[model samples]
Target: MNILFDVGASGGALLHNASEMDIDLRNVDVIVISHGHYDHTGGLLDALKIINKPTAIIIHPDALALKYAIKPKFRLTGVPHTISEIKKHGGRFLVTHDSVFLTDSVATTGEIKRETDFEKTPEYYMLIRGGKVAQDKLLDDQALVINHEKGLIVITGCAHAGVVNTIRHAQKIFGRRDVYAVIGGFHLIGASDERIEKTVESLIEINPRIVGPCHCTGDKALKIISDNFAGKFTEVRVGTVLNL
Candidate 1:
């Protein structure tokens, strides 16, 4: 079954590019939103339109909450599309706080457990309510786990809950220790040197066959991961497709 982990910032453009590669958007059976961030869910409404058929949208219920990044400057950074808009486009929401199986081999990470002390969500991120801003725990952050022949493949959007945490959660949920690969954002854009080092150390312990860091993963963090993983690291891009 064809599954889209997360639509890019532009749904129309992503569909156009997919068409160029001969990928039919209508074939998509599931759409998983990693988090509520705009960069991840901006194209969701458009994607619903292209699919035309009933598509299951796997996402954490908290994703619908109001969230924003307070650092640098105040701005709206949550999902740009509303629930009504999603329904208007024929998207079926499977909102949940527990792991959801899209098919026999595919599942959602649900809400990842934050076990790492150093990999805390940035304090600058907040959830606004009645003009009162509080720290955003980003509980909506989740990942997609695909069980393959070799091992499990974890696909993330902006991993605000922590990439290591996401991988560990996937392992526990799927009852698989072998992680074939981890693709997508690590959310270490402005992480400290110590945090990056610790994150790499944890990743080494739960070593996967390949690592593809993209989107919100910072240059320093990417470099660190590359240096550690060496040949196992792959550059992830919009048009990049993995056979597994």
Candidate 2:
């Protein structure tokens, strides 16, 4: 099985370009979205147009909404997708706010929950419902976990829910502590040095064989992982692929 990341950039890319990278789009049985950000979901239209066959599209429920915050004067800036538009291509689409099975050996950790007090989503956006603004808990932030014969490999997108928490949730869902590798964005662009250090410490315990940090993880954060976890670190780009 292969995990084809058609849309990984913050924006400005196409799912149709999979052919350019030598990825057989038809072989893809599943399409997993990390979050609701436009850059990630922007290529859905193109992808659905290409994959004419049945394919399961997985994402968090909160991602399908137009959300806003109060402290920031209740501005709406959420990317919400209509069910009709998602199914416009006449393909199978699976929606859920909890974990779902990808294959017999792989599963997607729906929304990584906040298990520790230190790990928290930024308090920037809030949901506006009935003229009431509430804390926007990104309950849709999820990751894909592959139970390989060697060990578990975690695939994440922006990781808005927190990378450490994402890993912990995968561990809880799989009931295993052996994470072979982790690839994708950690969303540490604007994080503090202390937070990054602690996060590194937490991940070090997992002893992942490969750590491919990309997208919004930022240069400084990636450098920290490179310097500290030298043996296992790798940089992720648009055309990166891994065999499982």
Candidate 3:
């Protein structure tokens, strides 16, 4: 079963890349949204329009909540399309906070538990309250766990919950410590040096076979991970594919 994870910043890019890869969007059996961030859900409308079958969209209920980043400037950072817009385009949402088993071998991490002190969500990130701003813990952040024969493959988008925490959650849920690969954002951009070091240390303890950091994983952290992980680190991009 082919599962299409978080759509990129826009439909145009996703469509173009799919075409290049000879992947039919209509053939996609499931759509999983990691969070409600604009970069991840911006192309939902266009994607729903193209898929022919009744695809199930798995996502956290809180992902639909309004979210924003208040550090640099005030701006809307939530999903670009509304639930109505998604439904208007034939998108079927299966929103839940509990871990969902998409298939016998694949499952969602659900709401990741934040147990690490250093991987705390940035204070500047906030959600709009009743005429006020409140810190956004990003409880909606989750990841996809594929239990391959060798080990588990964890895929995430932004990983607002914290990469180490997400990985640990996946391991606990699957009852396995052998992580085959971890692909997607680490969300370590603008993080402090101490936090980055702690994150890397945690990752090393888990010791996945391969690491593919993308999107919001900052340059500094990426370099540090790449250097430490050496041959195991792989850079992921829009068109990159991981063969399980």
Candidate 3, residue 243: the lDDT equals 78
Per-residue accuracy of model 1 over 1-244 as CA lDDT, tens digit each: 7888788777777778888889888889888888888878888887888889878898887788888787789988888987888988888999899999888899888999988898788788888666777888999899999998889899988888899999999999989899999998998988999989988999899889999999889999999999999989999987888776
User: In model 3, where do residues sit more than 4 Å from their true spots?
Assistant: 128-133
TM-score, one value per model: 0.94, 0.87, 0.95
The best candidate by lDDT is 3
Candidates sorted by lDDT, descending order? 3, 1, 2
By TM-score, who's the top model here? 3
User: Which residue pairs of candidate 1 clash?
Assistant: none
How many clashes show up in model 2?
1
- Best first by TM-score, ranked: 3, 1, 2
Q: Count the backbone clashes (under 3 Å) in each candidate.
A: 0, 1, 0
Candidate 3: deviation at residue 191, Å? 1.0
lDDT of model 1 at residue 158? 83
